[model samples]
Target chain A: MPIPLIQLAGVSKQYGDVRAVDDVTLELEPGEFFALLGPSGCGKTSLMRLVAGFETPDAGRVLIDGRDMQGVPPYRRPVNMMFQSYALFPHMSVERNIAFGLVQQGMAKGYIATRVAEMLRLVKLEGYGARRPEQLSGGQKQRVALARALAPRPKLLLLDEPLAALDRKLREETQFELMQVQRDLGIAFMLVTHDQDEAMAMAQRIALMRSGRIEQIGDARAIYERPASLFAAEFVGEINLFEGEVVQSGEGKFAIVQGGGRIALADDTPLPGPVRIAVRPERMVMSHLRAGSYAEFAGVIADMVWLGDLTVWRVRLSDGRLIRISRSNADAANAAFSRGDQVFVGFEAQSARMLLS
Target chain B: MSLVKKTRGVGDGGLAANLGRRLVLIVPYAWLILFFAIPFLIVVKISISVQRDGRPPYEPVFELADGFIGAWESVQKFSMESYAAIYADRIYGDAYISSVWIAALATLCTLLIGYPLALAMARAPRRWRSLLIVLAVAPFWTSFLIRIYAWIVILKDEGLLNHALISTGLISEPIHIYATQGAVLIGIVYSYLPFMILPLYNALEKQDTALVEAALDLGATPFAAFRQITWPLSMRGVIAGCLLVFIPAVGEYVIPDLLGSDEVLMIGRSLWDEFSTARNWPGAAAVATVLLVLLLVPIVAYQRSHLQTHGAAR
Candidate 1:
């Protein structure tokens, strides 16, 4: 709606025989925080580099603000990247580092000074103008890198795992700070991270990548609740998978599993042959007594892990199929199901969706 | 506390015993004091000693009773006379000036050539980097005199360059370039080029190329990235290369002697003439002292500046 601040259309990059980024086509709306989430070596960083003009697309085109980026070097592009290592100039002070881009752009000295001061204040590092990068803590260095990348006021800002170097607590704190900055500036931010929780916490939209291709792209909740592929469902969060065959596909769809018998599902799509049903672990209900439901199975608790907030129980059904169920600690405590205890696992028919692939 | 006492007693009985410890350290310490410090003191004493008429400025003559006068008269009577004599000789003066200018020019030439080579060295492929480095430094393993002499074969009147040019019909006659200022400069630059390159290669090699890309990303052109980021970051290498070239270039006598004509005088030749031909020990010492002073000032300045910049960065 806002003219899509950054557009990567069929962009692909190849290193020798290996395709690092394969036919990636995506858009980033203005003022939106977008994330590219994947494990290491999945081309998320390569995608960010392509957008930043660090690496030229081997085949397709990268467009920023509707202008083609062919033959345009990084400095001329209206995009800035914050490297994962922070890449702060070790020789320069905080103020100088922030002012580097402005100085290179030939802004007047006084204006550069004023803008740098304002940016330092924006990142809440106003008084640390004279300190070098090594003198600052990890969080402060991250802020300096952010301030430096933002000082130029590029149309799109690229962050490559900005919080990967920070400790756990610091990373959490800085994630909120980064989100606040992105929102306050109202600029499009493309963040690359392998951490699912980090992506969910920060990005408005996420592109989950695997083996150089986008497995799925959607809002945080959609990607978590309804992944388009088995890879995306498993990668985003834990899910209990039930392998079965589509025995009947009409108004009431049913899947007959190998070990377990037939179970009625909500999906009515014409999926033929074999398919798998995916359900969130938390969506499952576990009890010692067999409750009347659309689908039910008796199983024994093989393992029980008591986290303070939640409890995870591994259930082995009578057909020798394993299913994981997560319940709140209060509920699990009241039930008091330990290992070797028999339990009944049941879920609503509408909750489990049949994945054709 | 008891354990500390026991260890101390053992240390005192073992390697820290007075005689054994003294025996262990005395050889090297005494060697250094005798060979290094005492020799330096002897040179200082001889530099200030007064000269009699017949001897070689080392006659044992004490005139101190006449007003604490031996060293004082040496100062007043000898009184920079050798300095005056050497200064009066226009050849020595011109040679000193030429030496400084030639050394400075050669250092500049070396930097201009070596920087790009070092850059190429730093950017070479991983497998080729070691080969390039070895090639850059391989000239050092060959004899220095041999290398200078090799230039003789290349730059002589009927040498390889002129012969090739003539055979190619580029020139009708051979050109005499060997005994000229150009020849000396070529020789000096060639001899010291590796010195310039090694330091620069070391410094440039240590640079994380990501910094250059960071500069380019921040809106610097390729050349601008090199100037603002690469060059300043490699200042340590530049200083080291300049020192490596300048110090030896100023005192170099072999290349000039072998490559240039007698008309081209340098401080090294002047010092050689004073000692060998002119047989003026005091005058040669005076010239050597002048050369020493000339060389010491920049070395001190360079060290100070290097320390200051390094300290600031730290």
Candidate 2:
């Protein structure tokens, strides 16, 4: 197998009492689109900084392109970072900003001009070369930042919350554009972001981080369906948790003795003692009539919210727990349920994941 | 709409409010006219008057008791000899040139020294920044004259600096720094360093550090990043600091008088000599007026260009 483009072997960084990055070890193949997904203070940005050589790891090693990166300053590293704040030089024109990296390398002036034009065209900004950073709009500035970072053609590119400043519509448009650029260049990209939707939409694989530790690493579907822990289940998407004790076990089949009712799973291992079952809101089906095949909970709809494409119903179960169930608005029968109405919220056994913590 | 109508109502209270608003505008205008404009006009009148041996030492051209015709006749008696005398004398020319040269050199030295200090303070941890700022301005608490006096004690031939250098074997003899232009330059730079540092600190502190990081990440070395990013960005502060130091240093009196020898001619010393020793009030006024014009031209040009660029950037 070919060597990985970027690798961090048991890297750790500490800031006073807090450990910003705790023993993070990961690798990205060349031309891979990976994202470090977490909330603020989760050390995702710190991990990216470690790879970019901004913050030296307190322990372990950072390797890029099969070479150890110890004692390497950011200037000498074969990597670039697009900062959260665009960090464009306000005094320089757009063309100058894009050509900055090339000029630093002492490239030929003619080649620098050609490469700057190519980058500007790649970012879809052709005639804005002479304008200063202050003259550009937010989206234009973001494009300029991207162009500037990409001009050097590094082995890997690190982006720290590149779309956090844009509005929703702009963010969505830029997300697709960014993915396209990454694909076109075929360069490894490691994106750091707090927004789950942005990570889900742009990244090929997502590493969920919590409190300076990696909670789980998988594609969006695996992370959403098979969360490794309670934090992962709740952090990625909306999850309805059920506290139960597994009484029966064997042959990938188990029965959970919950306070409200007995839940039997056909596709889960029989873990003894108390466990928490996490079910995604969209996975659970709601019906007015009781369904005997699935593990069902009888409850009354306490709240109903009409989203654009789906309606979420909060059902107060007989055990005094509120379980949220979302139904597609495309179905006419699903709209029959309303607040104060009796309903049964059920989910397939395969959809529910048993959480140990 | 009701609030708008209420605000626009032409009632007695509204009239009183209008008068109060007018008073707010008029007070500062009255102060400028009385304190600044009138005094400036008096100086101009004195600068063109004939010097005489009297209590005031200059002929008063305008008399209120004399009517408008008599005032016109007195205007004819006003002489342009003081301005002509300053123009004809090479001493005044040499003083002007020396003052500009000294001030320009001091400003350059102050910029070189202040830039690094300000950059360091700006990059210091957030908790220590305020303390650093306070320390930078702490020298201002002492009297300016007393500080100059303190410099004398340290810079004299047998003083602390020379003794330390001698003891360290860095010098074989005591340097003749005191009572020279070098001492005056040192004094000016020391006194005006805070002026250079404060504005530079403000500018450097306001910069987004990511810009420097971006420069480094783009393959530029740390020094190159500073040259390409930090220096260009801190130019506004550089200009402000230079003007602050250069303007005052050009017309400085105390530092030159206390630290400089008789050979180091400066316009401030010449003006002082004309006023007290030579007893030439008109000549002194002429010197002061010329210096004011010399400083004001650059100040006005800098302000206009600053405003124009700022407006365009906005």
Candidate 3:
């Protein structure tokens, strides 16, 4: 393929004893929307800083458009970042804040002014150029940050929790706005966020980080459907995991797991002494009785939670294993299940993603 | 309880609170009138009075029979003699100009030394910040006069600094640093450094570090980032620190008397000469009034700008 727009090979950064980024290796295509998703202190922000040239890797090379970026300072790098705090210059007007990067680049005054106006228009903050950051609301500040970071037209744009400061309602709206901007501007975005749903909604590809290492790297759907490990399986969404040992295997693909009970799995490793049979809550089907031919486990509905569009049923097995089952609320008018009711939970063989690690 | 009773209780509390508020507001005004406004009025009265060989050193004109008419008579007795002397004499003019220049230089020196120190303390690790603040403020705990005396020992001809330099072969002869304008400047800058640093540290510490990082991310060099982001943001602190150092340094007596040479003819020294050596109370009071008037300009400017910045921050 035409050389990736950004590349990292065995990149690592250490803070005293803690490895903030441990051997992280990834690539992004031109105009790709990527995300680094993890909990706090997972080094996703550290990795973003590495790409922005604010950090120097201890182990590996970072490349932009196939050029090695070793020893490059932040100012020399072709990257921009939207800070989590939306660190707009409080002393400068919104237009001046956006034009700062262009001014630094020694751009013509007329060109800088036009670009600033265009950026303001792009972020839908027209006529807000003269207003200071302190005068703007939180959502307005976020837009100004976005417009300012985009004003420089760098090869890459890094966003550190860009939508986190906004409320849920505004966050959702800005998420789509950010996506539209990314698509229209055609600049690669590497967003760092702790919110899983945000990552799943925005990023085409996401790398889930844990303690400075990426546990899994794939499209959001693929990562969710086939998590590489138990951590990955549980981190992205709710997963009912059954810990077991491999007792049987056939065709070098499927394996049968024996824990307190047996669980058959398809599309799994042939050799697996100990593993966990993972299934997403939404993937499991719940009924009053065990279905024929499908892998089924009988349990009682221990708890129920009505979540407006979906209802989650907490099923406790005879072996004292708790599993969650999610169902759509399309038939909310005809509610059939409640707490302390007998239920049978089942999932297809293909859905039992066997996490080996 | 009945609504009428609740309303009555609130009314009673409101009256008491209004009385308390009025009392609180009157205290400062009363204090200012007694200590500052009244003393300044007395100085102005003395500044225009005639000097006599009496106890108070100036003619005390009072007539109770005339009442308000007596106050008008006292005003008529007032003369522009002392003010005319100040205008005709070049010494007072030179003293004023020199005082301003010296105070300005000391303020500049303090900023130069204090900004980096403040920046470093601000950027220091969290565990070190409290200790750094304590260290910066440690000088204030000792007596200010004792601190100036300590500087004398350091700057004397056979002082520790000269001895060290001579022993290290850096210089053969001792340098005369004490009782010089440079010595006075050094004393002022050293004494007032904490004033500059504390404000700077508070401002820099409270700044959002992400602003600087964002500047760097926008392709500005490190120095450029500091100039564009850090400096402008910390300007309020700079103003506060400069005012703190400059105002007091203008009328400073101890540092100048103890460390400065006769060549250093600051207004404080001039006022001391006019009052004690020359025994000209009217001349001294006139000089003091002029100095107060000059100081008021910056004090007012500082208050106005401070209010404006606080408003903008909100």
Which structure among the candidates has the greatest DockQ? Answer: 2
Docking level of model 1: medium
lDDT of 1 by residue, B47-159 (tens): 44444455564433334555665656544643456677767878888998999999999999999999999999998878998999889889889998998888989998889
DockQ of each: 0.58, 0.85, 0.80
Place model 3 in a CAPRI quality band: medium
Better of 2 and 3 by DockQ: 2
Off by more than 4 A, model 1: A249-251, A267-270, A292-299, A316-322, A330-335, B1-40, B49-81
Candidate 3 ranges beyond 4 A from true positions: A249-268, A331-334, B1-24, B62-66, B172-174, B307-314
Compose the digit string of candidate 3's lDDT tens values, residues A118-163: 9999999999999989899999999999999999899889999999
TM-score for the A chain of candidate 2: 0.96
Instruction: State the lDDT of candidate 3 residue by residue for B1-314, as single tens digits.
Output: 69999999999999999999999999999999999998998898788988888688988654456689888888789877999999999999999999999999999999999999999999999899999999998999999999999999999999988999999999999998988889999999999999999999999999989899999989899999999999999998899899999999999888999998888889999999989988889989999999999999999998998899777767
- The residue pairs found clashing in candidate 1 are none
Query: Taking the tens digit of each residue's C-alpha lDDT, what string does model 2 give over A211-254?
Result: 99999999998898889899999999899998776666465456
- Sorting all predicted structures by TM-score, with the top scorer first, yields 2, 3, 1
Number of the predicted model whose lDDT against the real structure is largest:
2
List ranges where model 2 is wrong by over 4 Å. Answer: A247-252, A260-271, B1-32, B63-66
lDDT of 3 at B85: 95
Ranking by lDDT: 2, 3, 1
Q: Write the per-residue lDDT of candidate 2 for residues B20-91, one digit (tens) a residue.
A: 999999999999999988888788889999999998999988777779998999989988999999999999
Candidate 1 local lDDT, A1-357, one digit each (tens): 456778888999999888999999988888889999999999999999888888999888888888889999999998888888887888789999999999899999999999999999989998999999988998999999999999989888889899999999999888899998898999889999999999999999999999899989999999998888888888888898888787665657677755545677655555668877788999987778877754677889999887888888899988777889998876635367889998888676667766766
State which docking tier applies to candidate 2.
high
